[model samples]
Target: MGNGTRLGRVRGLGSAHEGAGEWWKHKVSSGSNLLLTLWLMVSVALLPAYDFATIAGWIAQPLVAVPLILLVLSVTHHFRHGLQVVIEDYQHDESRFVLIVLLEYFTITVRVLAIFSILKIAFTTTGVAA
Candidate 1:
């Protein structure tokens, strides 16, 4: 016997049991993204100047760097999850697998580049030229 209605079974569709987890992850990332984005906007708004030195100095602070990193991670993960859903829904067969793998690689590359940029700025010595 199957877990769905007789009609559903006849139609060959069944519960995947995976959507709940993905939904929760999307909700959590969206919430974090909201808060962190607000923080980023306020922080930037309060800055005395938008010059490279000022921005770099601000990012170098541990307090700033940590949340910035969190924001980067949340945004990237959210992006990947959303795109994966779209690809899975719209694409078919082998192409779906290919698109998903490409999406994963693209998201990973972007996250790595973002985190690396943050770390490079955060750890660099003060008074360095841009």
Candidate 2:
């Protein structure tokens, strides 16, 4: 009501018009994670064996690989969002920025390694060692 808008002086007000998008993203990722987790359990349960050959062959299929990749991405995103809210809520000091940055870097690194491993197994592995 003074020389600036409420957000400029109120601090943390109105969500900076970003809360809805972040909320929706978090919820969507959660839903995807649940569905993919169910798929994983059922798929593995239906397998003939839990051996390396059996699992590798299953992941090599396009249908399986795609969903597995999606699951990885979704889980990574959900983890990031969940941690971000925690950081935002409990951390009020300047360290919050550093923590958030580190969180993002960590999530990215984990996601890349996970996806790469999945792809490698799906494409390069021969299912079982000779």
Candidate 3:
């Protein structure tokens, strides 16, 4: 028989078999977030100036754009995963599914917007106006 108590077996409320994967994902994402945040802070601090032109030129670099995209993606994924855990634990059954769906949509929307902005800046010519 399964390791759970008799009542757990009777109620069929045992493990869903997904928690470990989610936990590991959260850990990895947290680590990435720390590193990326430090990178962003140091990079910005070292910048010659924060004007539109200077910042745009900085983002236009391949190295800067790639890490910025990674930072956006990692942060959003971690956000959604963390919120999903909270919603699953505290939210009522009737509302949990809805909240998770909404969270996913919000995360995706923000991530896409940020990535798109980075890509636009990375690919555009420095001489272009607008």
Candidate 4:
């Protein structure tokens, strides 16, 4: 039952399609994540006490609102990109492709909605409309 080898029958297998751009995007995303994480950690640590009204006021401040919203957006974006890459690498198939695209779009939409919500909160606190 020994046919020596199957190497001679192997054909048409192409190389992977990964590019340098994906790697660069991942690096940039990681860097942004690191910065955002640091900001979040430091902000949480600076709070001596966490009360509902106190926290609301902090979130309303322009200084805190802008960075906090940015951090959330950046982190969400990074997460979506990283997960998409992981899915691309590990999942290979047409159905998976459609699912991955849907997932990415959903995550991005959620990120935008979250940022809008944060902006709404900040604006409301400052007594502004729209």
- Name the top lDDT candidate: 1
In model 2, the runs with Cα more than 4 Å from the true position are 1-14, 127-130
What residue runs in model 1 are displaced by over 4 Å at the alpha carbon?
1-15, 127-130
Lowest lDDT sum, 10 consecutive residues, model 4, at 8-17
lDDT tens digits by residue: candidate 3, 1-130 = 5678978756545777888999999999999999999999999999988889888988888888899999998999899999998997898655887899999999999999999999988788476322
Q: How do the residues 1-130 of candidate 2 rate in per-residue lDDT, one tens digit apiece? A: 3356765556543335677898999999989999999999988888888788878888888788899999999999999989999998999877787999999999999999989988998888665432
- Among residues 3 or more apart in sequence or in different chains, the pairs in candidate 4 whose N, CA or C atoms overlap within 3 Å are none
TM-score of predicted structure 4: 0.74
Write candidate 4's Cα lDDT for 38-104 as tens digits.
Answer: 9879888887668866676778888888888888777777777677777767877665578678888
RMSD of each: 4.5, 3.6, 4.0, 7.2
lDDT of 1 by residue, 5-93 (tens): 98875654577678899899999999999999999999989988888898898898888889999999999999999999899789766
Local distance difference test, candidate 3 = 0.87
Pick the TM-score winner. Answer: 3
Record all residue pairs in model 1 with backbone atoms less than 3 Å apart, i.e. clashing: none
**Shift in Å, residue 12, candidate 1:** 13
Return the candidate ranking by TM-score, descending.
3, 1, 2, 4
Superposed on all Cα atoms, model 1 deviates from the true structure by an RMSD in Å of 4.5
Q: Each candidate: what lDDT?
A: 0.88, 0.86, 0.87, 0.73
Q: What is candidate 3's CA lDDT for residue 20? A: 98
Q: How does residue 84 of candidate 3 score in lDDT?
A: 93
Consecutive 10-residue window with the lowest summed lDDT within model 1: 8-17
